[model samples]
Target: MTISPLETLQRVFGYESFRGDQQAIIEHVVQGGDALVLMPTGGGKSLCYQIPALVRPGTGIVISPLIALMQDQVDALLELGVRAAYLNSSQDWRTSRDVEQAFLAGELDLLYVAPERLLTDRCLDLLSQGRVSLFAIDEAHCVSQWGHDFRPEYLGLSLLHERWPHVPRLALTATATSATRREIADRLELNGAPHFVASFDRPNIRYRIIEKNEVRRQLLSFIKAEHEGDCGIVYCLSRARVEETAEFLCENGIPALPYHAGLGAAVRSANQARFLREEGVVMVATIAFGMGVNKPDVRFVAHIDLPKSVEGYYQETGRAGRDGQPATAWLAYGLQDVVQQRRMINESPGDDAFRRRLGAQLDAMLGLCETVNCRRQRLLAYFDQEIAPCGNCDTCLEPPQAWDGTVAAQKILSAVYRLWRERGQRFGAGHLIDILRGKPTDRVKQYEHENLTVYGIGADLSEQAWRGVLRQLLAQSLLAVDHEGYGTLALTDSSRDVLKGERTLMFRREPEKKARSTRSASARGKDAGIVLPPDAQQRFENLRVWRSEVARGHGVPAYVIFHDATLREIAMNPPASMDDLGGISGVGVRKLEAYGEEILRCVRE
Candidate 1:
């Protein structure tokens, strides 16, 4: 008897229905058609291919990039009672041979292999002799060189379609702009395949960008006041910073661990395992972490430095609130981040066009940081999606006041011109700002800049306000950093307009005391919109404890045992019996049979 996709979904997994285009994509792929899926991070992209893999004949081959991602997926599949295995360098030779034998014997429902492993002759011979259901390429954006996570082996995926013309293929990615999308299709030879592009908006994530004052203090305050006892990620730019931040958080009584590429493989593995199993553990990591993490209850993702591109920022921030619960995406940025990024781009080993593309991406990210309008709308607009202002972001809840800075901008530009053009001396923003604000520091006196007309002209504005103007001026392309001159301020062609008084500069004033107080009150009130009653709140904690124990016993991630959403439902309703528990949204027949009685007991207690 053939089990349909929907039947399999309800039986093996817990979902009763498909989300977005999952049902349609499954049907098409099960009918032996190729597909290009562009879904959001937490939008159930895996179900689209996983269900089809099970319903189709033979074993579904998944080409994945990271070992952690593949292992996580396989573990989840095993929990769902699906036979899944992965081939990677982490496994021993004997273990790999056994998995290969099982695949050849048709005992496995799904098999995941890295692109490098899949391209090998041994794996190719094994697949050729066995019946292969289809090929699913996860993280398809990695095929494009322009993408943030490009993999060279992915460029060779075109051979899969060339060799197995009859086998259906599905290429999936959570983040891809229009250019990256086309590049992925062309490189993977999925040109004519149907594209299923879901909306890129992650509405549950509250986006907030704060100006940097005290980095560690701000992060600690946010965590203590807003997200105490939550599982979240703190992204740092360097490996040393990751370790330091993790240590700092730990010393401050927060359970924190560090993960980065610089760590030993075993240490990295252990840290990742602990983060997956433990509750309310904060992970401090570089971009190396959080890509393949299937943790659904990550309440926030904080960035200490500016991301290189908007796409990367979007993908990283999307890691938060995957369970559709309230989460936060917080970032702290300043002029130094802008200068540092500009210097790195200039120093990159790429041709003019390549650097230009990267520069454009950085510009977009800066625009989002400097935007005065709704954060969500501005972020979605980068992906070509227009959204109404979501009232959840910092800008939306507490609108910022934009003041005309034409006079101030002129004063700033004059300082840059006098310092570089007249004096033939290139000074960084520190000295330039000093000249503008008329601070006669040692450097100012040594360079005789105190005599310049523009010196102290910006004295009306505070130092922070002047910094804001310079940062915005850089973002607007009126002022640039001279990379060869150690990041000294330089006037771009556009600076002529601002200096000529032909262009108007509007800047977002620093957050007012009233707005800051309002934000603080809102942050203190946990789960503002989805506030649970006293009873439900206690029950939710009980459910979490139960989930952590069960997941530890089963040696799987807590979310695999049961999502926070599922537990929320159970806590709210307090299911009376097995039948009542089985009626929950995420409770499928398998889960109902496995944990229904235990769940009911917890709810009753």
Candidate 2:
């Protein structure tokens, strides 16, 4: 009389299997246990709750924070022929009434409600009237104030446990630090619920951080040279920056659109939808956008400004390359970014505890930006996780080179002093470099520094190396820029060390010959061969169908029994017996026992 989870998965969702741990979590929830799911962007977090909701006896309640996110999910479920609906501010009066009627009639299998909107009398009355199969919290990291992006409404969601203590619950997040993780458990009232943590590292993304100078030229060169016709998100610190940068990018022939809280709601929606649908569209935005953005093929995520924290950076960068293809996470940072952020913190009227935690998080983010170690190792270490020196980030591929700079440092300091003697210390690095290079700019002529002894003393170095020296000096606190004077170069207490050779500068080589070969045979037309083997394609589809049916019948992901590669093997060889299937990788002992006959039956049929 009762339908099993697998049968429901197949009949309702048109799938034969589950992916990853979807089935294990589904089984736990269906058996009335709480769960916490930390899956990656395209790792299929929704299905963990969605399938179990369909399998369990009563209506599943999904506590989502974003109304738009809920709408997207409900739309997706409806396409699969699932009886799912959402209650949110976006719905009209009549639609809200219809959702209510559906609930009372037991016609809806899943209902999504925003955390802030859940405690109303109407919602409580509706829930109190029926059994809740599961309480699914999407974007569960928002519950922690310590997290990079926290929402107070998410903290309020803990009352779900008090209201429906017996109902199984599952909290899901794409990103969370260890501190934030503990807060999520405490604030969500997890009552010692088991946790499912997927690896936080995204191996597919290539991380790179360029020193910020010649901002427009650097950005334009990167856009033109490497990532032409690729969809990317450029994050700025404020609405004005977002607007100006988006326009500048557009003027430079990049198809860029701006998104921030300043834009009208409809315009933002249209821009986002266009980005999700159109390839090669660039979206410039603040931190407010990109959450719940389901675009999986974003090729790059570039930050023109420093993000608030590493978690925020990771989550934003993770938005790219979700389709498992190679992607890039590019960033640019200068000293001013830190000063501005610190000033903002110093001036904030918010909670002291909040500000302190936020400041510490920012420092860690800065360290990540300036780290000389493998960027991947530094990042993974920040989360209390570990990884070997990932040979994937920009530094690992082509590390920068440096000089002792003891002599060059003395020359730079002397030039600044000589200029200060003649013209006063009111010039930026350009003026200092110009004087040192003996460039005949009118200002140099006016300053009468063409005859100075320090002039032409540093012309042996290239312009880029000079710039690198200036940046490293700024980083070392040997020199600083006067912000009010439009960043004039100024000496610091640490400059004495450079003058005495107490400190020698070390820098990375500029674009060393790297193993990263972009123009491979695949990129060229050299490998312009046939698309897919027809036999392989047909077999892959059949294996997928078989796996889907089995997974739907058993309530798991199709890939869990055997990955796509193993399926390809099955389809390619049309495996003659159990031994043949068992010989393939990923077809382990449990998988062989559970789905051997089903697979062989599909092959025979």
Q: Backbone collision count in every prediction?
A: 1, 22
Q: What C-alpha lDDT values do all the predictions have?
A: 0.87, 0.75
Q: Estimate each model's TM-score.
A: 0.96, 0.75
User: Residue 465 lDDT in model 2?
Assistant: 70
Question: Residue-wise lDDT of candidate 1 within 68-137, one digit each (tens)?
Answer: 9999999888877889999999999999999999999999999999999999999999999898999999
What is candidate 1's local distance difference test score? 0.87
How well is each residue in 100-192 modelled by candidate 2, as lDDT tens digits? Answer: 888878888899998777877778888888767889998898888778778887877788888888998899998887777778988998858
For model 1, how big is the CA root-mean-square deviation? 2.0
Which window of ten consecutive residues has the lowest lDDT sum in model 2? 521-530
